[model samples]
Target: MAYIRPLANGNFRADVRLKGITKNKTFSTEKLAQTWADSIERNIKAIPLMSSAQLLEITEADIESMGGEELFKQLGIDLFAIRHCAKLEAINALSKKELLQLTPQEIERMGGADLFIKAGKRIRYKTFREVCDEYLSRWGKKDYKGQMQRVDYWCQFFGDRIMTDIDIFDLREHVDDMIDAGDRATTINRKKAVLSSVYKFALSRGYVDENLVRSVVVDDDTKRRDRVLSDQERQRLIKACQVSHWDKLYLLVLMAMTTGARKGELMSLRWNDINFKDGTAFLGDTKNGTSRELYLALVVIAELKCHQEIGTGLIFPSLELPEQPMDFRAAWRNALKAANISDKDVLNTDGSVKLERFTFHCLRHGFCSALSDAGKEINQIAKLAGHKSIQTTMRYIHQGRDQKRQIVNELAQAFNL
Candidate 1:
């Protein structure tokens, strides 16, 4: 909990005291002030007690004595720039002599000592974690779990970094690190998108005048993986799952291939989401953030009916935690290996994974590929797949023999050849 008060200067002040750690920032708007208070308090709560104490006890004298640009570096806070004691005195936030005399705890109590020195370059800084906290609190309650997961990932990447210190290069390098570590582009882009959202949130609140995340280039071609299992590969995959005796994994892959549903959406399915008689299922949670009904294949309907006879709640409940969906990662990887879909995993002398990953999401690719090969129009495929945009489905329309033949026939008929 914290407090927000309007000052005579037409600015809003927000302050919170947590486990003796305090943050007090003033903003031009009440919304901004409240947001900062909420975010700072939340971050303080999330921090380990020792780390929070370290942050709280950084003395003003310790910083002022470091002098000019070297102050931030010595403090290990901001690498870019910082406001010096003279500037703080000019703003009447502190007197030069008084600021140098105050302890970090005293600075906190006085609502002075703008956190993070910017190497005398003066960065209007905000903590990445706090900004993410503000981002989630402002618009995240509706999608708490999903949004929090993104926030958590961003916190790990930046770790309470001064937002101004991170530029396009840093953002790109972080994403590249993920790529080199064998993360799928979608995963990397999703994390990048979270940062972008936070920057946008900050921009709206006047935390900073710029949104640096916008300048970071994402591969235009690789936003989503277009991988699909071939006919032989799909057959081998089923056989491998059968051999593994993982009944749930088999049904999970089958459902994904037949329905084009996302991993989370499929995981969320219950007997109630499916209507076996009507051969349809309703998705309450989807990437598009809307609910929609999708037609089910006869085979999928039959599978659901059989499973419903035995399964109680979740269609894919965890083996250990029945209320939650099973972690399909291990079995899925083993199946991929058994199907010979994966390349050699034994590291080379220099040490590198020999294969590209084909994740469970690829099963949705197989579903879309099947439709495109059957000559369904892009819009029809989009509707069936519950995609909010037909443009997204257009990516799946590969030009196979049927499509080529249609193009050839159209050209020939037009020329009367």
Candidate 2:
């Protein structure tokens, strides 16, 4: 309802009151005052008179637009009390046999399983496998095979177990099992990280109350690798790659050794990423999500030119598929054998790695180490290796014994003592 009245100053005032909400305004003309009052009254009446249960559906913005919290209080609505009563109602409703028969979708529409749990209802939670499937489906990254493998291993271990049931104790047992099976600290930590990521996804979707993986501690006792190829080893490895069965293996190893690019980064490259005239390669996709440029050596550029394809497809496309990146694991192992770079110091009877041996990654280490040995600045090495920190670069920069001895001798000479 609204009332319009004339003021002594020849202006008009309008007052609108409805459902305990009141708003008043002054207008220059009686007609304007009447229009304003009518508008206000209509707007106030337009707001539906929601029940206490339905009031929970109103967002803060909706409340704000409808004259704020004070207006709701004036209308005999207490948000806090409503929420408390709604929780009780929801709990009581869940106890009904008819409500228990509701589909999962209906239950979610009413309020998620969390709501029923608060009501003291023991609901069937999603299995670990179901959670993994959902998590993988939502994964948007270009590379997820390694992550998928880790998730698969977890699903196999925790088969059919509900996510809420796998607590810190189960995670600890998993870690112990891995340790007993001779899994390295690094491997165990990697698996734990993957599980932690899954739990984080589950947490966001309200599948779990907490990430139990956070409570499980795994010791990372594995030492940082300082292995770098010697000059002779580098030569042998290059020659071995050159004569390998896979034609692309040579160029791949060369690019990896010279540019210090990770295996995935190089393998994902397309022909368009290279610039023959500038002797440069543009890496738009990298591990750190930062774009970088790799200056190609003349030898590498020459090899690339020779291997250049007709289209802008992958530089190292699979020979069979021609659309996917080539898998050169077997070829790489063969090259390592040919170069006499043993994968382990003392191989097991089953030919498994008992001790760490030289790997393709050592080529990257060799590149950084070589640059550091040549007196390059730490910052320069970091930029070349696309390392976000100089500390990471330092880990890869292992100087030979002779270089260390020479530096000591030079320091002593300078002291003249």
Candidate 3:
């Protein structure tokens, strides 16, 4: 058995002096030294020593069952002054503190799980934020707006907690809290999706054993909102866009309403991105890296070429720069106000809207609704909207012709179809 002894220098150490055993392993911290001694004692008890004539035969699993600490002890392994340093060359090596220091962005830059394993020094409880950064850096900035949004949502909902601290219960509570806070079921689900991805990342990296999100039970009391613009509302907003006098805003809206490119991709348009000769606009960066090709109708081409300012690199150059794209927030607000849409009444305190659910994104909805009303195919609609899936495009189509009947019934209710 190992015991603690005081040195002449007034420091204490663990001294395990046994015949035929390594001796006098000193420790600055008494508790650590004691742990070391106890581990060695346990190893000696488990494996009886044998003379040269007869060897103590033990299976590999027998040694492993004692755990890394006891197994190393039984083997009479003396780690360098820093125990972790010596184990760095062995299996099941990890550097907990060092792993904690790396940011998510750093992890993403290191690439996939294989790369992450190679790069991360063993760490304990790698925080969610670190994982988030790595996910973002790996996914890159442009394509991960939704993921970034979810990361922000989690950070705001629950301060900066370490990754290991997250449990299935915490995620369930967070979803419940969002529901109580009056978020749309869809929005809540989207946030859940982000959380799910984080858990998946943890599992893939061997950080967590299971995905907590998969076990989470979402509340069925959530509401589904896929509000699309009516023809009258569309016309009103169109008029508002025209009144703002940023013809590009009007054109941008028209493109979204006509082709259903996402607001960001549309606003990010440049002269070089347009191929007027072939009548197609090449979208370089999009949600999917498909590089969408949108056909420019005659009306779209006319609107674009009419105010085609010379020497401006951006098709929608900023009014301030006259050489760059303009900030669209002020323009968007004015257009909404002109349409008589009061944000206070429409949007909730938490930035979620109820009935007249509206945003720049609604223009794409307007386009989809127009197509659905016109009896377009799901695949055709998906391609036009640049949707990654037919189901995503079909969701905008709605069902049972109820919305379609409502359009006809509106006229009949007023004046007998």
Per-candidate TM-scores read 0.65, 0.65, 0.58
Candidate 2 residue runs with Cα over 4 Å from true position? 1-153, 180-184, 201-210, 214-222, 347-355
TM-score for candidate 1: 0.65
**Full-model lDDT, candidate 2:** 0.82
Which runs in model 3 stand beyond 4 Å of their true positions?
1-125, 129-162, 172-191, 215-223, 245-247, 309-312, 317-325, 342-355, 398-417
> Over the stretch 1-417, how does candidate 3's per-residue lDDT look in tens digits?
588877787666876655355444577777777887777666655544433222234345654544343445545643221233323343234355445444455444434234445444454345677777776777755546766776777767554666766667788887888879987666777677877887787778866667888887665422244556666877898889887856577888888878888866876778878877888888888877778898888888888888675442777767788555578888888898898754433766887755654777766766776777777877888888889887777667643367668878887889954
- Candidate 3's displacement at residue 394, Å, is 1.1
Q: Rank the candidates by lDDT, best first.
A: 2, 1, 3
- lDDT comparing candidate 3 with the true structure: 0.67
* Candidate 1 lDDT over residue span 176-197, tens digit each: 7888998755667778787888
The TM-score, computed over Cα atoms with residue i paired to residue i, of candidate 2 is 0.65
Candidate topping TM-score: 1
Point out the worst 10-residue segment of candidate 3 by lDDT: 78-87
TM-score: the better of candidates 1 and 2 = 1
Best by lDDT: 2
